[model samples]
Target: MPRSHWLDPLARRVLQATGQLPPARSSATSNNALARPEPALPSNWFLDVNRGSQQQWRELPGCTDDMADLLVRLQRGGVQFAAADDLFRLLDLPTDLAQLWAPHLVFNWYGDAPLQPVRSCIDVNNASSEELTSLAWPDQRIHGLLRERRLRGFRDLADLQERLCLPASSVEALIGRVSFGQRRAGPSLPPRG
Candidate 1:
């Protein structure tokens, strides 16, 4: 004979106020903790100066409206910053501010935060005519200077006029863009007896 399930007459009334529910099962598929999205991270120092919005720059540590404006102007002006020192020189800011902001700055026109060991400029003493032609300077003027430089290198900016017979105004204009430093020399040999 099959067993029959049955309830007592008072079972419904006795259990009326006592709610009953199935026990919760541990779930690997369902989330056990609250879900939260990650926050947006801030840009690095170089990026903050090169590409940051005016408001973002103002929000940077120790940055004022004047400072932020100048940074934006310098970036837009196409100035190539080779290091934090260049930024300090360009802005003429207080030493304290430069020191404070240096950690967040980069030395190149690009926004990447790579540390550049040397500031690059056109090496006038070693550049080929092809390289000189790439510059904004006048082709004819550069050619004349190149010929003179090949014969005997320029001693200084002042020498351009004397050595190549270039105009004073042209030399003055090119001085800021060109580097007069000698090329990096190879390792020296030991002194001979």
Candidate 2:
């Protein structure tokens, strides 16, 4: 057989013999490659506002030297915010700062709890009627409406009511809830203490 005719089949057999190919690069990884670096930490004390107040705020254990230097610079420059806030934003503080500074500062700070996970909508183009109805969307009318809309190729949310038999109100309600992208998985449970 000619090389060109045999090459494709030979390559396929080799690939199949290898079991599975390596996983493709994730979207997050590709996005990170294109993103700019985060802004650098502010080092100049003259620019800080919390310069020299006697608040006796807690510091990260073993970070005394760096913290003291940062505080002194801020105080000398007459900066007027809590050292904690400045440090928090400057370092991109972890979700739990108490854990980071444990045994040093008996962390008494309280803030709003982290945001609850939001439920993402299904991709109307590829979703089955069962999946569409599983969202507790009232009735089969909605599912049939979505199916019809998919066939016509949805241009946008507004086109749903115009192109399908769905009620205008129902279409509007689903507008903010539905998405063209895949649904995200729910948040993972934290490890037991």
Candidate 3:
């Protein structure tokens, strides 16, 4: 039931007299402006994918419990996304869900930063013999790689993989741990005995 028209003025007078809500107090802003409500609170933070915690991801709009846990698991397992595509592909996130959460996600690289392990990211074209050996690759693979780089440096990960005969799985694992920067003409690794 609607309040009677006559009671509207009486209610306003009562409220004003009680000083609960003062009249003319909101006039600093125009009456039209007061009629509109604020849409939402603004946020200024973006989620850093590589370094984001599960809790942080869970706070986003569309993240599920499984998705949040999986994200943490992948990060812990040394998996880092290079972009939105990796997150979508690895998590098998739906297009609509990804779009809903895209604005909040960031894929910043936190390589070799404090508390983040370097994981022996050896450089094939530049690392010394010892550093090259530190990679979990086989002895023959390392020796062969050292020999090939002596003639000419690897063009990129593909070139390195081809020369070493590294399997698809090995190559996939090497994605983030190795980089293919411009091959420097530094002194080559001493010949392995």
On TM-score, the candidate that comes out on top is 3
TM-score, prediction 3: 0.39
Per-residue alpha-carbon lDDT of candidate 2 for residues 58-127, written as tens digits (9 for 90 to 100): 2232334444554454334322232343344433346565244323322232233322222456566556
Residue 51 C-alpha lDDT in model 2: 30
TM-scores across all candidates?
0.32, 0.28, 0.39
Residues 25-105, model 3: lDDT tens digits: 456566666787432213565889888898888777667777787667556655566667556654557887777667777
RMSD to the hidden true structure, all candidates: 23.8, 22.3, 18.3
CA lDDT of 35 in candidate 3? 86
Count of backbone clashes, every candidate in sequence: 2, 8, 0
Error of 2 at 115 (Å): 20
Error of 2 at 141 (Å): 1.5
The runs of at least 3 residues in candidate 1 whose Cα sits more than 4 Å from the true structure, single-residue gaps closed, are 1-47, 108-193
lDDT of 3 at 50: 81
**Reference-based lDDT, residue 15, model 2:** 71
Error of 3 at 180 (Å): 1.4
